[model samples]
Target: MKIREHLSLLAVLCSMAMVVLDAGMLNVALPTLSNALAVGPADIIWSVSAYQMALLVGLLPSAQLAERFGHRRMFVAGLMIYLAASVLCSVSPNLLALLVGRVFQGLGGAVIMALGIAILRVVLGPDRLGKAIGWNALVVALSSAAAPALAAAILAAGSWQWLFLAKLPIGIVALAASIGFPPSNSTRSSIDGVAIVIHAASAVLILFAFERLNSQPAMATVALVGVAGLARWMIAREKMRQVPLWPVDLLANRPLRTAVYASVACFTAQSAGLVALPLLLQLGLGTSVIDTAIVMMFWPVAVAVTAPIAGRLSERADPSILCSIGGMLLGAGLLIACFSPASAGLSPYVAAAVVSGAGFGLFQVPNNRTMFLSAPPDRAAAAGGMQGSARLSGQTFGTLLVGLLLGYYPTTDAVSLAVGLGGLSALVASMVSFSNLPRFVQRHHA
Candidate 1:
């Protein structure tokens, strides 16, 4: 790549890393922050959920706003909000203040995430998109993989406030680097106020319902009923608009929709396996918390190894076959891990983890490439938004599923069952991905 392109990609990755790091770093700091703020663990958990809810609800709408205002304008504005929110979180004297900062921070992160890949596409151009996306995925994986260790170091050196304070420099660097993108020529189009409300409401409701499923079944049922009613109205409202906030038009394309299905299934399996593995490792293998964490690190590190190669290879290979094979590999790896003998050391599990992570790396880049490139250039922001939402929704569902299973089946090895279910999800992804094979063949010629 050219020097300019390298710098541009660096800027985009920095923006992504900035948002990702916030969540990752906060995970380890939760107990420390909880004690310091004098809040119960359950209440402190809201600090994380607040950001998640805001991000989930704001992603699509933020993309719509970015399209109207301009990506650069939205990006710079997001940085300011994120940085300001970080300071708020750092000095918060209580849980209420911290939750407020987290909410705004998530909104800002949503704006950044919603446009990061779109900006990367503009920076690198389509011919190199596959490889660039691979790099982006690798960066995200590595950032997540490193978070626990980094958060531990930070907490030992300072306090929980420094975790939020640490975001300032990254945000500033990203802001300076990203200001050079050409301004959007999009006119001051009147965004759909009603549609944005419906979309955001549906997202928040869905997330809330999923989180409540294991804890409060009655509340979750009510939320689902509300979501169903709202979704029906949203479909009717979005279909008539030329540029719908829901992007039902883009989703109508068979290739893109199939790709989305595959993406969602793959991520559901990914999250479920990750969540269940820790418990299974400690119980089945008798590994310590620290040892289990060390073993789990192989997954993302393996992803870092294969994601870029998948990106580079997608340029020449048919992504359908690559993605399908990746899916099968992932499922097979998970199943292998499940059947691994308790007497066998961590080596078998570690190898399985590597295989599963590498498989995910191979799947994600090409899958995301297909999803993004299938849309018209004007729909890039929406496509990316849908892509992000799909992954997030799947993750939430996977975690919820495991939580409910554990609660309902006390004394059972729910972790192994969850891992088995994760395998099933991966197989589903493979089938869905292969179902889109004809499109790949036809698109290559077109």
Candidate 2:
């Protein structure tokens, strides 16, 4: 049973780690790709944008597809598509080819991520799902933190193609293991292509608006207004359907709604901190790239250390308490960071990173467990889709905040503002998580 648990997790979660690695490494390699392809910065950025847009547009739809077909088949097909796209990305000779490959890669990533929770519930059952989530969180946190460092090392030693190629061996093994895994039950249902298109349109509009906001405020505002209208329409349309692609039914449950709120807040805090810290260290403080990387590295290390432990604790503990404490720890860490003296060395910054990362791990494991398990088993895929959506939404908003801040202020001031907002978001997460306490606990407090 233990061996089966380990193998099942590896077969499923390895793709997640691969995706995280790919994202981080590809981000670091963007400048190199720009130079290699002889494209301007504007053109090169489209590669990342294209991937993100595709991922966002495809995520929920992929869940529906998985439900209609079989989850196991969809997952295996996603792995195949992802691997094939990676090869295309690695061999591409032109910008257009790479962009096309990235779009497909993003779609495949969406499929894998969307079904992750559902698959875990199936393979591990109720007994082990919580720990598996912790392990999953650990894998993502570690891979995300390590990706840049690994990319830097690899780029120093060899070609950028290696970044995409690195996941191949792991992909092959997961594919093989996937073939042997237990079959998944399919929910026979029709997919609403129109609804998918509408949701994708709204997401794209908002994403494009965020990107354009720093450069074109009037256009961005207009796009945002359009997005709001589309969002309203989509919500009304989906709410009437028995099982919309948007997970509207599951979201109506108070526990799940609260979980999603806290999930978004936690992600917002992490995203804000991630985007701001680099600018703070490199541009504002005039620190070296290597030094900045080292100090920032500590945060993920802290996450790595805390995630599995938190996972174990989540099985028997109150997630509300764990999540509330986790959010505050992250908030406190970021608060400490914003106050760092300009003349101080890296130690203080490292301390902040460690604290923040550890806090993130604490909040993530239990929060995700709640998010995944809150839904009825039949709707688990939808819950998983919503879970991913919440994360992406939070990250987008957090990044948008940083971009807006940078537009209005200098590096130091912008980072400070961003950090402050991140801290505020973390506190909100803590408070919302605290609200998830049992009635007796709430009444006692009241």
Candidate 3:
């Protein structure tokens, strides 16, 4: 890679690594955080949910901001916001303060997450775009692999505050690297601010309803009604706008539709595993925190190993087949996990981690390439927005669904419920995968 390209890639890796690390590390620290802050279990849950909610609300607006200001500018700005939030979190004395910082952290996270890829796509040019994404995914896989071990070490030495503090230097380095870089060519759009608000509101309301529906059904019903009404109004208002935040034409495209569906199903399945597996090890097989960390390492370790392999294979064949295979493998792995005997110990979890991670590794790059390529060059911002929104939306729903299941079922049944959900998601994704069957068969013949 040329010097500029190398720096650009480094900049993205630095920012993304911190984001992924923070996510994994926080999970392990939740117990420590709850006790220190005198928070109820319910409030402690917000430490994660608040960030996701911020990301959910910020997606389209972040895209619009990128389009209006510039991707590089937004990238730097996001790092600063993330840094500030991390500081707030490290020092927070109460549940509400931590939650507030977390929400801000999500806003920062949303800014960089999608735009990082979008910037790489532009800076690297289309020919090398797939490889760039492959490398980016590789970094994510490696950093994610390190997170659990790193978190456990930090917790061992000090308080959970170190989890937030750990990101500070990385964030600072990212900000510095980003600022020193030469700016990419600016692409501006006349953004629809009102539509952005409506879209954000609609997403927040819907997800909130889903989160609340079981505990407070009447309140949830009201929220659902409000969400539906807002959604209807948003669509109507968008029709009147010149450039809606969620463009109608882009979404109505067949390929974009396929990509989004594939994304939602893929992540839904992935999230169920992510949430369930670590807890299963702790709750089911009686693993320690460090042991769970080591076991969970297989997931990102598999992804880091398999991404280049997936990239190589994607060049020789249709990506759809790769996605289908990935979906099937993920499902199969989950099924094996689901049926394993209690005496199976750590083996089932390990198998599931490696297989599902490999599947996700295989599925992500090609699917992302398809989504970015399928959109018009001028509207890459819109394409990136929808793609990010779909992934985030899927992930949010997955977590919410799991929360609901845990609420309704016995605590002892958590793993079983997760397994059931994973199996169902896989079956649905497989049916979707058949859309690529002719290509899969032809590739085999060749």
Candidate 4:
């Protein structure tokens, strides 16, 4: 039984790594893809944008479907879809075909992301849940850290097609292993097709607006207006239904809501810092590209090292307290980076990176555990979907914030200011995290 559990966990982690690695790998291969497909840079970007938009839009629907069917069935099906789509992407002769494949791939990725944690919760149960989630966080960190290097290596060895082709074997292995897992016996529920469509359309429009806001203001404004109307309609429709697709009941829980908000703020802060740090290193500090990359490696490495420890600690510690500490550390790290003297050199910057990375790693596992455990077991899939949505939303907002700041200021100091804003965001997240503690204690005592 233990061995079987381990195998299942391995399959889950591999699927997760494949999706994350592909997202990062494509960014590095975009230029190569453009030249090979004889497409403009603008056209090539849709390969990425299409994937992201589809993933964001499909998350909730996928979760609902998982609940209606079964998590294992959905997970295996998603892997199959992703694997097949990768083959399609690899063999595509033109930009349009690749774009189509990417959309399918994104849909598959969405299922995996939305249901992976929920599946983990079921497999590991509450006692070991934190550790499993911590390991999952490590997979994410490692995939992100390895992506650029892996992409460069693949391109160096063969054509860009190899990038997609490489994932085929990994996906196959994961799919095969996952087949041995038992099926979920979740009760099937009726889904509102109209509600699903409205929710998906609203999510897509909102994300699209964020993506286009800096480049095409008019289009973004139109998208924003569409999103608002769609959202209003969805909310109204959901209120009328006993079982809404959006998991409104879960969001109503105070602790869960706080965790979600804190998650968004933390990711927003992390994303903003990630964007600003490279600029500070390369443009402001006069660091070379290679040197900057090497130095920046410190952060993810710290995260990789810290996540497991935090996970173990979470088994005994109050996750809220850990999260609060993490938020403060993250904020402190960013502020330190913000105030680093012009001549302070790489050490200070590296220190800040490690601190912030560790903080994020610590915060993530506990926060995710809170998210998963807070919901009823039956709504695990919904909770997972909400978690993914919150993360993507936070990242999108953070990226947009950085873009706006740089566009408006267009100065060296702008990076510092943006990072400082990120720090403030983390501090706010800390406050939110801390606020959950008293409630948690009261509930425990009761």
The residue ranges of model 3 lying beyond 4 angstroms of the native Cα positions read 179-188, 240-242, 282-292, 343-345, 433-446
Model 4 lDDT, residue 209, Cα: 86
List TM-score per model, in order. 0.97, 0.96, 0.91, 0.97
* Model 3 agreement with the true structure over 248-326: per-residue lDDT tens digits: 6677766566777888887788778777776767887778987787777888888898787787776676778787787
Colliding residue pairs in candidate 2: none
**Residue-level error in angstroms, candidate 3, position 326:** 0.9
Could you tell me how far off, in angstroms, the CA of residue 392 lies in candidate 4 after the best superposition?
0.6
**Candidate number with greatest lDDT:** 4
TM-score of candidate 1 against the unseen true structure = 0.97
What tens-digit string does per-residue lDDT give for candidate 2 at 1-446? 66655666787788899889999999999999999899998999999998899888888898888878878888889899999999999999999999999999999999888887788887788667878888888888899888988999989999988989988998888887775456867776888989988888888988889889989989999999999898888889988988798888898887789999999998999999988987888877889998998888898889989999999998888888999999999999888778888788677788889999999999998898888888887777788888888898899889989989988988789998898789889999999999978852766778
Instruction: State each model's CA lDDT, in order.
Output: 0.86, 0.87, 0.78, 0.89
Evaluate residue 54 in candidate 1 and report its C-alpha lDDT on the 0 to 100 scale. Answer: 90
Weakest lDDT window of 10 consecutive positions for candidate 3: 179-188
Task: Provide the RMSD of all predictions against the true structure, rounded to 1 decimal.
Answer: 1.5, 1.9, 2.9, 1.4
lDDT of 3: 0.78
User: Candidate 4 lDDT (Cα, whole model)?
Assistant: 0.89
Q: Rank the candidates by lDDT, best first.
A: 4, 2, 1, 3
Clashes of each: 0, 0, 0, 0
Query: Candidate 1: deviation at residue 410, Å?
Result: 3.1
CA lDDT for candidate 2: 0.87
